[model samples]
Target: MPASAPLPKSARRPRPATDYDVVIIGAGSAGLSAALVLGRCLRRVLVCDGGAPRNEPSPAVWGFFTRDGVQPSELLRLGLEQLAAYPSVEVCSLRATEITASDQCFTIVADTEASRTRSITARKVLLATGVEDELPPLDGMREFWGHGVLHCPYCHGWEVRDRALAVYGRGKGVTGLALLVSRWSKNVVVCTDGPGGLTNKARQRLQKQGIAVREEPIERLEGTEKQGLQHVLFKNGDKLVREALFVHPHQHQHTNLAEQLGCRLNSKGAVWTDKKQQTSVPGLYAAGDTTAGMQQAILAAAEGSLAAIMINEKITKEECV
Candidate 1:
């Protein structure tokens, strides 16, 4: 072993780093909420939002105390407006496309726009990029997604209460949803759109509960501006008139950054995190719909706040900056 030699002329030096205490991807409810807490703690934070939230189609977001009935857009506008007071937090209308984590800091590459880019480095990273609904490939389904065709009964049930409603799915999923929805509307029907796929016992239970099961293949959904769902037309030429339709849509992660970073996925196919919201990778965390918890704006915000607190405490233990 001899003394270290000088670097070769062709060797590339490390790139300049634009640093922050935390870089949050997805400025939706969860990311913004975490940014609020982290900013209040005086942590330098950057939030990159691609825009078009998972709930963008929803008319109003409910279940949040003191803020029910607020339009989803208005709710986020208010969040960004209030976050402006915190000088430590900077929100950007950019999409984070890539993430690289090392023992010290995580490097992020984000697309500001077409062919434009930005590089960011942070001591910690929070992924709040939620899931996207995989709506049924039926005509008119996408058009009425948020209002006419709904997901959570608790979210939209009251508005459509006592009206004719339909649940779109198969097997136990539709049955369970139909039963839950029956509480909202006595005229609840489960539309399997093909085969009902119910056990005899399940069918008996549904029959006992006064819920109808329709197994005909769906032709298409006909809708009108007055109501999101006008009717469910069947291939057999019979149609069921319904006021609204509910579904437990299949969902996928909005961003692949977690998988790119090798974060373990939970049984629900969401990012796996410890009770502290920390992911498998150290100094990296996740919250909101991205986690295993059921998706909700208020819940995501709370999870974001909790993740920020944990991040701040970890930083304090490591000698806060």
Candidate 2:
């Protein structure tokens, strides 16, 4: 038995059996949506959620229709509740550790909360496992992440629109993102954290817009999680006052399951998928943030729906043959 107590009987959902038609490796918007479609199609589907959502820190998930401004945890709860109506679907709060394929079947080994491991076999697999953002290692950065510090402007831009915004990061991507952040806030500064590696053309363009460029390395972020970001301190003993900071973090898949299964990765490190959301490996599929760079709940759900549809079609055609 695990050291922690199990969920109350009322809170526990039935677990899926050993063999399944499909095993979805994430329970976020994309995985849950895919599971719903596959379940309604009468396919035996299991959704394994590791219980860690990238958007958990965000106050609300934006840009999603009907559920706009909804809390990420609440949105996931509602999705899980809706999925309960489908008898063919089951959810396991476990993390997939390994995946192996052989002779038209795939075996998934996952670490369970019950202090034991479980293995299940499925005919097909969906890699909805999203990416983890690699934010810069700066004091107080993690404390204010997703609140005062954010990535997607469309998702969190409206709330901080017109606020004193600063772009904080390095590399060429930061230059473009800083320019983009200018749209949400007229008063913007680009804190390159030293040199910024920006081309002369980019610097001239930013200068034309009257955006202050601070090329000093950030020493620390001064603020409490409650008070939000106050200043970006520099090694030169100067500080830039800002309300929010935008970053374009380099992200990687949350797990190595895709790589273990031999799925090809694109240049940006996201899982490469075709128009149908099928990965390079046959019988394997991917969706959501893992498949593209533009990370949004609605877009991920749409990709999940598309992946489910294609998977259903693929399975049906296979059966017919």
Candidate 3:
């Protein structure tokens, strides 16, 4: 025999439609990580991303082992590249409009950048869609987000360590956040912006920690064009010459998908996930900042991996029967 010919397409077995085993919404670290594991397990996976990530404004993603200080965009790009190696995974740059569940499947409606609408169905849905930080309403505060204004001390503390850092936020939790920020800088001031309803014991605790409390209302954040944040001005004609500010902002889901799917949220407003990262609804899962208080890239990726393993196991068990 001289040579052997490959089988023709019609002669080969028919292929199934593009139905997916799992559909992942949000292609951030969590979503991409989940897709990677699912793809490696030989599961048909689809990842849909809206292009706007919570860390888009941040210059770097910190606290991630082996990839600390990496730019958020670059990290996600590398993750997608790794996922591309798996033949079972497909990534789409589209915004998910709505998701509806019926029986054991879900239909996702999404809109593309070209204004085209597409819908896909999957056996399971994983919402790696993260949370949106709602910054307090103070003039010029929006201008310094991810720069001079930050939320997590672990994320931005080292850079501003030993600098004049001001902790500005409302509610009782802010007192604790200020205390945590104090670890990074001895010169820390807590500006409640108003009567924070802090107990006398709480004030004593802060005082014991050498953190000064400013109860005046914040009028605006003053920043220079070159130096970023310069001071926090108060309505009472007082100002704190702070170099950086930390805040404990209220956060909510970036999209209504969780609420629409009736996923139970904890008291902290995060999606309630079990040890397996499975949501209240069977066949549905969640991970990342939307499901936890300790938001970090590495932790979110770990959660995504956990969810993927559980999802694959569920699918495998179902197929075995």
Q: Count the backbone clashes (under 3 Å) in each candidate.
A: 0, 0, 0
Write one digit per residue (lDDT tens) for candidate 1, span 239-280. Answer: 899989999988899999999989999776899999999999
> Which residue ranges in model 1 land beyond 4 Å of their true spot?
1-18
Colliding pairs, model 1? none
* Regions of candidate 2 where Cα sits further than 4 Å from its true position: 1-18
Q: Model 2, poorest ten-residue lDDT window?
A: 9-18
C-alpha RMSD in Å of predicted model 1 compared with the true structure = 5.3
Across 7-30, the per-residue lDDT of candidate 2 in tens digits comes to 765676543334999999999999
User: Which lDDT tens digits does candidate 3 get at residues 1-321?
Assistant: 234876765675543343899999989989999999999999999999888789888879999999989999999989988887999999998899899987768989999989999999999999999999999889877889988899889888998999999998756787889889999999999888898888888889899999998989889999985798999999988878999999878899899998998989999789999999999988889999979758988889999999999999998986654
Candidate 2 lDDT at 258 equals 85
lDDT leader: 1
C-alpha positional error of residue 217 in candidate 1 after TM-score superposition, expressed in Å: 0.6
Clashing pairs in 2: none
Ranking of all predicted structures according to lDDT, beginning with the best and ending with the worst: 1, 3, 2
Alpha-carbon TM-score of each model against the true structure: 0.92, 0.92, 0.92
Give the winner by lDDT: 1 or 2.
Answer: 1
